[model samples]
Every structure is written in C-alpha cells, then in structure tokens.
Target: MQGRNAGIFRIWKGVTVSQLIDAFERRFYYLRLSITDVCNFRCTYCLPDGYRPQGTRNTGFLTLDEIRRVTRAFAELGTEKVRLTGGEPSLRRDFTEIIAAVRANPAIRTVAVTTNGYRLARGVAAWRDAGLTALNVSVDSLDARQFQAITGQDKFHQVMAGIDAAFEAGFDKVKVNTVLLRDVSDIHLDTFLAWIKPRPLQLRFIELMETGEGNALFRERHVSGELIRQRLEQRGWRCQPRGRTDGPALVFHHEDYRGEIGLIMPYAKDFCASCNRLRVSSMGKLHLCLFGDGGIPLRDLLESDGALEALKTRIAGGLNHKKQTHFLHQGNTGITRNLSYIGG
Candidate 1:
C-alpha cells in the first residue's frame, strides 16, 4: 500500500490504491464534490442576481454513474471525508440518490453537505436518514430586508426553519456558514449571536473572497476574520484554539455557551499549507486549486477496461499540479469563476 507521512492507504472492493499525495507532500483525505452548478438563491458576493449556471450536461457536469464511479475511485485512493457542494447541491433532481450513492462506499467515513437551506426544512429528514454526517447552511445575515437583498430571495424564514429542522432531525453537527460583509457584519453578528446563543449548532465565519465579477466589490465589503474575532473578544467572548478542528476552520468555543464559533480566513490567513482537499466540479472537471484552472477530464476513461488503474495514475499526475495557494486578485481580472460556477 502506498502511503505518505501522517496519511492512510485504502482498499475498496479489493482494489488497493495509494494514499492521495500532492506535490507539496500534503496528504489528501477530503474530497469536495460539486454535484450541481445551480442554486435557487443568488447571494450578492457569490452569484449576483442575474448569474446563470455554466454547467453543461455533456461536458462540464457529470452524470450519476460518472459521479459514483469517480467517488469510488477517490475513496479507494484514500478519501475519508466527502462533502457535497454546489451552486446548491440540493438543486440536483436526484440529490439524495447521489448522496446515497456516494455514501455507499464503506471506506468513505463521513458524508457532509453544504446548502442554502431554502428547501431544507421540507427535505431535511430524508437527507438525515440517508446517512448525512454533517450539514452546513449558508446564512449570511439575519436582517430580513438585508437577507433578502443579499440572497435575492425572501425565504429567510424557510431557511431558519430548515436550520431548526436539521437540529431536530438529530444532526449531531449542524454548522452555520456565514460570509461576513464589512458594512453590515457587526450588526449581523449581533443578530447571529443572539440567534445562535441557545442553539447547539456551530457558527463559522468565512472570509469573503472576490471571485468572478464580484471582485469589484471585494475590497469594500470583505471583512477579515481577525477583526470579527477581536470584536467578539472585546464583548467578553473568549476565543481559544480547539484541540481538534473540523475541516479548514479554526474553531473556538465560549466558556459560557454550548455552541462554538469558527473562522475560515482563506485570504486573511495562508491556510493552504494544511489544506487536504481535491475538488470535482459538477461537470466532471477535477480542480487542484480553487483559483487555478487546469483540470483532468474523467468522463471518457471512466468507462474503459483498465479505468481504475488509469484513474489512479491520472490522480497522482493531477496532484503534481496542485498549487500551493489561491490568489484572490480583484474583479474578473484574476479569478474569473463566480461562486455558482465554482460551486463554492
């Protein structure tokens, strides 16, 4: 079995593949799957009001079988945690089927989903029953009008209900992912704290990145995680490093509260060194870095005779291309992918 420092090898269906290793020697155990490139709500910083999906059925996106096979391959190659992402992964017509298919691989230990929670309240039970290990709901602001303005949707109540449903459905780990806006963050934080205080969910603040056409507004609206943490500290909330962290978040809990808070500062902090991930776009393109664009297409070979062997070799080659960091340059000038297309 092929292995790397601090990494594990895998055997799926008697096919033993090497551990996932990138050029920087980082061992990868997490795979992020973009099941679809469409969402019901258009968040201002992610996908503006008029943004349309760029996924193409024939080339850009993957079919159910394609996703299943690739996930199996990745699982065999040592992917322990799998997260379903999207424009909104729930937008896929057979969303649960896809999740069930991915979760079917016994080697994949954790199955998580990131969604906007628009349709979650109604469908939360089904997903929870399908072996969903964790749920991350994107709730940017608590202000009704501000929430409506940011998401281009007036279903804030529905989203909140979904969050409640996730907790009620016995999801042990329900995380609230929020993208802080410089102008409205403090006010938003107050509402967020008040709402999250009594809940058992974890609230994670993600530093906003300028992707696609949203770059023009990045400098003005982007609020650093450091500032947010300082604001919380000043308010008598103690922040400390948690002994164990989940994903890329730097998590901490308040001594007085049951719930905790986390920070993912992609721009403000250089976190690429410890990043253990590989991304598969909804259309089947494999991305080594969020900002870089070189991808290995797997559709054609997935049906071949020696497909699994070829896939392992190709994955190793792809790891050699992983960039150390993502540069969030301003506007359409640097990172051209919008949130919807990138499935962030």
Candidate 2:
C-alpha cells in the first residue's frame, strides 16, 4: 500500500487470497483493469466520434506506482491474467510502464490489452518487446466507407496499416473485436474473408449491448451470433470449436482458412456460467459486475497508511457481492457505463 511494499500483499482480508470466490463458487483468475477513461475514436456504440473528453479535478487518475500497487494486490489474490483497457489504452502516456509493472509480477502469467489499433502500427513493437502477451484490436468494419461511418473518421486505412504493422511485429495471438450493428457491421463477406483467411489472427463478432444509451438502438441494430453462424453455415462454411478455456471467447476455425473466428454473444448465448473475471475501473473501483449497478472505490485505501487490510476488506465484500450473472435475474435493469468510460 505504501510505496508498493513487497510484503503488504500477504492476505486478502485475512484469508487465503486464492480462496476468494463468488456466490456461484466462481474463482476469478482473470482481471480486466481500465488504465484510463480517455479515448480518441467516436464509434456510435462507444462515444460520438471526436467527442471532446470531459475534464475533471480528479483527472490525476492512477499514477504508474498506484497501478502497480493495485495490480500487485489482485495478483496476490490468484489473478493470473490481467488485461489493460481504456477509452483506448494506447492513449495512455504511461502505457508501457503499466505493461512493465504488470509483467514484473511473476505471479501474473499473462498480460494483455484491448485497443482501437490506431497507434498499434507504431506501438506494437515497443509493447511486444516489453513482454506484452496478447492483443484484441477493435475494427468494426473492413470496408473503408462503413468504417468511416461507424467511427466518424476516415482513418480506416490508417488503422488497417496499424494491423499490418502488428503482424510484422510478430505477435501470434492478435484478434479483432467487431461489434455487429445491423447496417453498419455487415462488410462484404468475400472481401473481409479474403483479408483474414490468410492471417493467423482471429476475428470475433460481438453482439451490440446497450451501455449509457438505451436498448432501443441495440434492439434496432443488434446482430445475433446465431444469425452470423447460420449465414456462414448456409454458405457451406464448416467450423469446429477450438475448445479455448482461457478467455471470454469461444473460437472456431474456418474449414479452409488458416486463421480462426469466434463470437461473444452475451445477449444471445449466456457464458456467465463459466465466467471467471473481475473488472477494475480506471479510477480504482472494484466492479463486481460489468453490467451491474455500482462498484466499491479503493482510492482512499490505496492512498492511506493503513490501507492494505481495509482494501482487502472492501475487495472481499465486493467479491461477495458479485452477481451470479448480469441482466438474468428478475426484472432486468441494465446498468452499464458508456463504452469509453468502461474501456472499449
């Protein structure tokens, strides 16, 4: 807690840290932490493209040491996987420092990040060399015009260039995050497949979920994973599940393609039964549920002299409060921040 003292991470509220479990008996080994709420893209589902960020007094955010401290605490609690996110994590000035700190913890076996890929062309080499393990790049559409319409920018070529750079940098496990909007996300299948069929990366089609905006938009445009799989199957595309057990995605490879593809259909297909993750906000709140009502703030504890035990207490309480699944109980009241604030 104080200067990231080594032995300060001995316990999680006076219990074996690894034993931290939820009401469903789920042991969280993965943590998705937002490094910043700032981003550049204005995708319709996230922020309005080029929207000016709101300035705040507490914008000091978490210093590099503070991130390391909190990450260390979770790592001590059996968090083997940590993924950094933000409005765009690449926008962080200390992105590399944060990655370094995450990797420094020997207990953390894998460190990853999700970004818009605008800066990956230049940043990938640096991050890969810094021991960054994996990446999930957001590219809603492959068609230039559709991409511009979705992100309100003509940087489609630039982002694609960044992906090429990532490939050149040689990270093997890069994947794409495509939010399926009705008219916006259906890129020409032939063109899109041609682009990815030869590459080793996986393209994941995500069902659109309502965040700050209401469900009307989502209901109007959301493309179900079942539909995509059906269309592909109709086209004679064969798939076999890869049986991945580590991440949120359930991936499959095309019968004739070298790369793979997957779907994350939170709305259509429920994967909450096997969920094993905890998400921390950029400002130090422990989010028990990504779409839940609220979180427990840990800034005061992290900054105070006698903070470790208190942090453990709050963290344990947060874990206890973790929902069995989000938006599945009686009278569903969807609670989610804007995609940017929660880290797209």
Candidate 3:
C-alpha cells in the first residue's frame, strides 16, 4: 500500500481509492450528473421560452463513455448514489444505456433520474428494466390549466399517467418536484396535499432560488418554504430526520397520510451544512457548489479509460477547494444563467 499515492486514502476491493471530502469535512455520497441540456417543456421558473444554446459555439453534451468514466471515478471515491439530471434526461437517445452504465458500478447503490416526465408513461418500463432505481418527475401543478401556464406544456394528464405507469413498472415510490412560486404554487397546495393522500409520492416543494434569468420573477413570486413547513407542523405532521445520502429536503410525515412532504429551502439558515452531494455539468465540468463561481474541467481526463487514475486524482484534489456554502443569500447566482444550463 506504499504506492497508494497522495490523494487517495483508502483501499476498496484491493484498489486504492480516495474519499471525496471537502476542506469543511463534508463527505459527498451523491452525485448529480447531467447528460443533456435540452428540455422539451419550458417551465416558467426554469426555462421560460424553452432552452436555447448558451452561446454561439454549441459543444455537445457528455457521451456514454464519458458518463461511464465519471461515474466509475465517483463510485471508487465512495459515491453511492448518482442522479442523472438535465433540462430533461429522457431526451437523450442513450438514456437507458447511461442508466445501465451508472448502475453497473458495484459501489453505486442507487441510480436515479430527474426528468420532465413527458416520456415516462411509455418509456418508463424499459428504463426501469434497464436499472433505473429512483425517479423524480417535475409536476409543477395539479390543475391542467395552471400546469400549462407554469410548464408551457399541455401534457398534464400525460405526465400524471406517467407517474401511474411508474408504479405499474414496479417502483414503490416516486418523488415529485414542485417549485414554490408565491401565488402560483400556493394556490394548488391543497390539491397537492389531497393527491398525495393515498399514493406513496413524496411531494417536494422547492423554494424558488434566484438565477440570472429568474431575478425578476424571483422578486415577484419567490415564496419561503418555511411557510409550508409551519402549516404542516400545525396539522400534526412531524418532521423527519434526513438520511446521510438524502437530498437537501427537510422531510415531514403525518400518521394519517400515506405520502410525505419535503421542503427544500435554500435560503434557510445553515442550509448547506448537511450538503452531501456534488454536481457535474453535462459538458463534463465539476461544479463544487451549484451557485459557485465556475467548474473544474474533467472532460480531458475522461477521454480514455487509461486516464482513470488521473481522473480519480483530479476529482479528489478538487474537493480541497470546495467552499463551505453557496451565496444565494448574498444575491450571487454565480455563472449559472438558468437551471437548465447547469442541469438544475
């Protein structure tokens, strides 16, 4: 074990691997990997007018091999969960292949995907067969008219059927993401609660975070997730402790309800203290923080399998520079113009 090297500090399956720990002593167990930036639905808070190329030169997304390399490297470093995200991850032609590749890693226990649910009804069974373990579909509203107004799509009923299809496909639970947008989200809170009464859906109300393109709307409609949390508490919903590998949601449970509620409030005090995940853009750049300055390029090391050791070393070394928290409270959205660009 003398040649174990500098970055690596542990051995797994007779191979030297490093733990992805930051200077703040936070260890990462989950990775958010984006495979594409193209999304079909234009969510009002995310990509309002639909996704456009960031600039003139469009450098495509990560290939299957690149995805495999990155996931392998992270798994070696103790990443147990890999969440494939995008403007909509299902948009990729090789999405099932991508899922199988990530799930192929022995160290990775969960292979999750966050999509718009446009393709989930028909394609979810195949995706589940291909090794997708967890699914998060964006359902901004339950009302069809409001859903169209929020997501710029008329596929409300279709997406709902997709959720039903997911359960038929053998998934025990499906997490639904809904961004809390003042009057927009608040108006349908009762409907959301009623819909989850019998199903095992974890309806997560995400606090609207300000991005470069969402500044105007953030001011006009951003609502604190605390408001919902207080109401749930008063209704006899007890707060639940988050698991180590869980996302940044403060989950709550009620004895009478079959489903649970989760609140993701980024602006909450000390919100980043329990951070246990890392993000990589579809273009192969590692984002230490979603709202950080810029990314560290890892694409060069991912070009070939021969650079696997170098890839692991680069990822481990980069963690030393990871900051303690994001600056959303300070009104600095970093280089992210919108959620789709960085796979939010």
All-Cα superposition RMSD per candidate: 3.8, 5.3, 2.9
TM-score of each: 0.89, 0.87, 0.95
Top of the candidates by TM-score? 3
Candidate 1, lDDT over the whole model: 0.77
**What digit string (tens of lDDT, one per residue) describes model 2 on residues 285-319?**
88877787887888877774356666665676667
lDDT of residue 252 for candidate 2: 66
Ranking by TM-score: 3, 1, 2
Task: Report model 2's TM-score to 2 decimal places.
Answer: 0.87
Clashes of 3: 0
The 0-to-1 C-alpha lDDT of every candidate, in the order given, reads 0.77, 0.74, 0.89
Extract clashing residue pairs from model 3: none
What ranking emerges by lDDT with the best candidate at the front?
Answer: 3, 1, 2
Regions more than 4 Å wrong, model 1: 1-18, 55-60, 235-245, 304-306, 329-336
